[model samples]
Target chain A: MEILMVVVVGVMFTIATYMVLTKSLLRVILGTVLYSHGAHLLILTMGGLGTGAAPLLSTEGPHSDPLPQALVLTAIVISFGVTAFLLVLAYRTYKQHKTDDLDQLRGSSDE
Target chain B: MSNLLILPIILPMLVGTILIFFAKNHSLQRVIAGITAVLLLILAFYLAHEVYYHPQQTMILELGNWSPPFGIVLVADMFATLMVILSSIVGMLCLFFAFKTIETERAKHYFYPFYFFLLTGVNGAFLTGDLFNLFVFFEVMLLSSYVLIVNGGTNYQLRESFKYVVINMIASAFFLVGLAYIYAVTGTLNMADLAEKVGVLEQQGVLNVIAIVFLFVFGAKGALFPLYFWLPNSYYGPPAAVSALFGGLLTKVGIYAIIRTFTLIFTHNTGFTHDIILALAGLTMFFGVLGAVSQFDFKRILSYHIISQVGYMVMGLGIYTQLALAGAIYYIAHHIIVKAALFLFAGATEKITGETSLYKMGGLLRSHPLLGWLFFISAMSLAGIPPLSGFFSKFALILSGIQEERYVIVVVSLLVGLLTLFSMMKIFMYAFWGEQKIPTEKVDKKETMGLLKPIIPLVILTIALGLSAEPIFQFSLGVADQIMDPSNYIDSVLNQD
Candidate 1:
C-alpha cells in the first residue's frame, strides 16, 4: 500500500512539474495545486499507513499517526489560500498586460 | 517568563489585525502603527535584556500546556531576541519612512496591516521551536510580502512579483518535502527533539540529503548563488520603502534559519554540509560582486550588493567558530541597518532627481550636502571603511577565517570588499559628485530633509555599532556559544532541567 502511494505521488509530481513549465498562468496555478497535493500524499505515506481506528475515539489496539494528517490539513488550507491569491494575481496580470504569455514579460522597465 | 517568548510574535499580529479597520484612514493608520512600533520596540529590548541577564536559560512557551515532541513551542534565546530587537528597530524606521513616502492609494490597501503581518511572521519564525511552525510562519511572511511587493500594482511589480511568487511557492513545496522526510525518520517535528533523535541515529545519509534540501530552500530565499536570479529583478520592482524592508529583513530571515538548522539539527554531518556552505559562500560572494560591478542603476547595484553581503554572513556560518558566528551575527545586524538606510537614501535621491539610473543624474553634493554626506557615511560603511559597523564585522570574519586557514575564502572576501567599495564609489561619483544634472532650482531642501530624517537613527545606530564593537562582539560571542551547544536549548524546551 505504501509503495502504491509513493508511485502515485511520483506521478503527480511529474505531471505537476510539466504543467508548471508551461507558459500559461492558469496551468501554473493548477500545477501548484497538484504539486501541493503530491506533497501531502507523500507526507501521509511516509508516516506509514496504519491499520487502526480513527485517532479521536478510543481504539482497541494501535492508532494511525494523527500528526501528519493534521499537518496535511493545515498545508491544504494554506495552499488553497495561495492558489486563490495566485489566480487573482494572474487575472490581474492578464487584464493589465493583455496577454497570458509569460515570455513577453521578460524585459525590465528600462525597455 | 516563558510567556514573554510569544509577545514578539503575538503583539504585531494583534496590531496588524486591528489596523485593518482603520485602513481607509491614513493618519489613523500611521498613528496606530507608530505607537505599535514603539511598543514592539520596547518589548523587543525588554526581551533582549531578559535573555542577556539569563543566558543559560532558554525561554520556552508551549501552547495549550502540551509537552515537547507533541506541543508547539516558542523558544527564545539570546540570538533570537537580538534578532527581534534588530528587526523591530528596522521595522520602526521603515514605518516612519513609509509614513512620509508611501502613497495614500497604497496605504488605503491595508499596507500597515501587511507590514505588521510580515513582522509577525519574521518574529514567529525566529521564535518557533518546531520545523512545521517555521514553515507556517514562512508562508505567513511570504503571503504578506506578496501583497506588499505588488502593493501599487504597477506593470513592473506585477511582472516581477509573478515570478517571485512562483519561485517561492516552489521553494515552500520543497520545504514541506524536506520536513516530511525528516518527520518520517525522526517521528517528531520539534527542532530540539529532532536534534536529539538525529544525534542518536547512526545512519545519516537521509539526514544529510534533507539538510541539502533545506540549504536549497533557504539558499534560494537568502539569495545564495544559482538561486539568487530572482532577487535583483523582483526587489527592483517595489517602492523604495518596501524595497528597504524586504532588503533588510527578508533575506536575513532565511540566513537565520540556515544558521539555526545548520548549527543545531544537522551537526551530525557538518564535515559534508559546512563544506558545501563554505564553497557556496565563496561562489555567492564572487558572483554577487560581479553582478554588482555590472549594474549602473542605483537600486540595482544595491540589490546585487545585498547578494554579496549575504555571502559574507554565510561564510561566517561556514567557518563555524565562536568568533566567526559572532561576526555573522554582527554582520547581520549591521547589514540590516546600513542596507535599509542606503535604500532609503536612494529613495531620497530618486525623489529629488526623478531618476534611479546613475548616468541620468549628478551633482547632488552641491545642492543637498546633508543628503550627500549621509549617503557618503552609509556608502563608506557599506564598503567596509574604517570605524564603521561594516569594517568591524568584516574584520572579525576575516580574522577568524585566517586563523582557520581558509586562506582562499579570505582572499576572495578581501577582493570582494575592494569590488564592493568600487561599486559604491561608482554610485557616489555618478549620482552625487558630478555636474548638477537636474538643475539646483528644482531641488526642494525641506522635502529632502523630511525624507532624510528617518534615516538619521539608522545611521547613528550603525556608527554606534562600530564604535562599541567590543560589548556587541562579546554579546554575539555569548549567543554563538549557545548555538554551538544545543543541550540547553533542548533541555529548556523539554523541561528536563
Candidate 2:
C-alpha cells in the first residue's frame, strides 16, 4: 500500500513539473497546486499507513504517526492560501497585460 | 522569564494585526509602527542580554509547557538573539524610512501591517525550534512579502511578483518534502532531537541526501548562484523601502537557516556537504559580482551585490571553524547593515533625481555633498575598504579562509572583492562625479535629509562595528562556540524542564 502511495506521489510530482514548465500562467499556478498535493501525499506515505488502528498517540494498539497528518493539514492550508493569492496575482497580471500567457507578460527583461 | 522568548514573534504580530484596523489613518499607523519598532529593538537587546547571561547560555521556552521532541520550543541562543537584534535595527530604520517615502496609496493598502507581519515571520523563523515550525514561519514571511511586493500594483510589480510567488511556492513545496524525509529518517521534527539523532544515525547516504535537499531549499531563498534568477528582477520591482528591508534582512534569513542547519543538525557528512557549499559559495560570489559590474542601474547593481555578499556569509559556514563561523556571524551583521544602507542610498538618490539608471544622473556630489559623501562611505564599506565594518568582516573571513588552507575560494573571494570595489566606484563616477543632471531647483535638501535621517544610524553602526571589531568578534566567537558544539544547543533544548 505504501509503495503504491509512493508511486502516486511520483506521478503527481511529474505532472506538476510539466505543468509548471509550460508558458501559460494558469497552468503554472495549477502546477504548483499539484506540486504541493504531491508533497503532502509524500509526507503522509512516508509517515507509514494506518494499521487497523486510530491515530491517537495515547492508544496502545498499532497506530499511525499523528505528526505527519498534522503537518500535511498545515501544509494544505498554507498552499491553499498561497494558491488563492497566486490566482489573484495572475488575474491582476492578466488584466494589466491582457494576456494569460506568461511569455507575453515578460517582466523587466535583463539588460 | 524564559517566556519572554515569545515576545519578538508575538509583539509584532499583535501590533501588525492592530495596524490593519487603521488602514486609512496613515499617521496613526506610522506612530504605532514607530513605537513598535523602538519597543522591538529594546526587547531584542534585552533578550540578547538574557540569552548571553543565562547559565547554560540558551534560553529555552517550551510552548504550552510541552517538553522538547514532544512539542514545539523556542530556543534563544546567542546566534539567534544576534540575528533578532540586527533585524530589529534594520526593521526600525526601514519602517521609519517607509514613513517618509511610502506613498499614501501604498500605506493605505496595509503596508504597515505587512511590514510588521514580515518581521513577525522573520523573528519566528529565527527562534522556532521545530523544523516544521520553520516552514510555517517561512510561509508567514513569504505571504507578507508577496503582499508588500505587490503593494504598488504596478503592471511591472504584478508581473514580477507573480513569478516571485510562484517560484517561492514551488520551493516551499520542496521544503515540506525535505521536512517529511527528515521526519521519516529521524522520527522527530524538533531540530534539537534531529541534531542528536542525525549525529548518531549511521545511514550516511540518506542523511547526506536530506542535507543536500535542505541546502537546495534554503539556497534558493538565500539567492545562491543558480537559484537566484528570481531575485534581481523581483527585488527591482518594489519600492526602495521594501527592497531595502528585503535586500538586507530577507536573504539573510535563508543564510541563517543554512548556517543553523549545517552547523547543528547536518554535521555528520561535512566532507560531502560543506565542500559543495564552499564551491557554490565561490561561484556565487564570482558570478554575482560580475552581474553587478554589468548593471548600470543603481538598484539593480545593489540587488546583484546582495547575491555576492550572501556568498561570503555562506563561505564562513562552509569553512566550519570557530574563527570561520565567528567571521560568518560578524560578516552577516556587517552585510545586513551595510547592504540595507546601500539600498537606502539608492532610494535616496532616486528621490532626488527621479531616475534609477546610472547614465541618466550625474554631479550629485556638487548638488548634495552630504548624500554623495555618505553614499560614497557606504559604497566603500560595501567594497570592503578599510576602517569600516565591511572591511573587518571580510578581513576575518579571509583570515580564516587562509587558515583553513582553502586557497581556491580564498583567491576567488579576493578577486570578487576587487570587482565589488570597481563596480562601486563605477556608480560613484557615473552618478555623483560627472556633470549635474538634475536641476538645482529639483533637489530638495529637507526631504533628502528626512530619508537620510534613518540611514545615518546604520552608517554610524558600520563605522562603530569596524573600529570596535575586537570585542564584537569576541562576542561572535562566543556565538560560534555555542552553536558549533551541537550538544550545547541540543541538551539545553531536549533535556530542559
> What DockQ, on C-alphas, does every prediction get?
0.78, 0.88
Global fold similarity of model 1 (TM-score): 0.98
Listed per candidate, the RMSD to the true structure in angstroms reads 1.2, 1.2
User: Residues B277-349, candidate 2, lDDT per residue (tens digit)?
Assistant: 9999998999899999999999999999999999999999899999989989998999999989989998988
Model 1: DockQ vs. true structure: 0.78
Error of 2 at B195 (Å): 0.6
How far out, in Å, is residue B472 in model 1? Answer: 1.0
- Cα lDDT computed for each candidate against the true fold: 0.91, 0.92
TM-score of each: 0.98, 0.98
Q: B1-497, model 1: which lDDT tens digit per residue?
A: 37888889999999999999999999999999999999999999998888777756478788878888798989888888888998999999989999989999999988999999999999999999999999999999999999999899998888888989988988888888988899889999999999899899943788889899999999988999989999999998888888999999999999999999998899877789998999999999999999999999999999999999999999999999999999999999999999999999988888888889998889999999889998999999999998999999999999999999999999999999999999999999999997988876675778887898899999999999999999988988888899989888888787554
The residue pairs that clash in candidate 2, if any, are none
Q: In every candidate, what fraction of the native interface contacts is reproduced?
A: 0.58, 0.84
Cα lDDT for residue B44, candidate 1 = 96
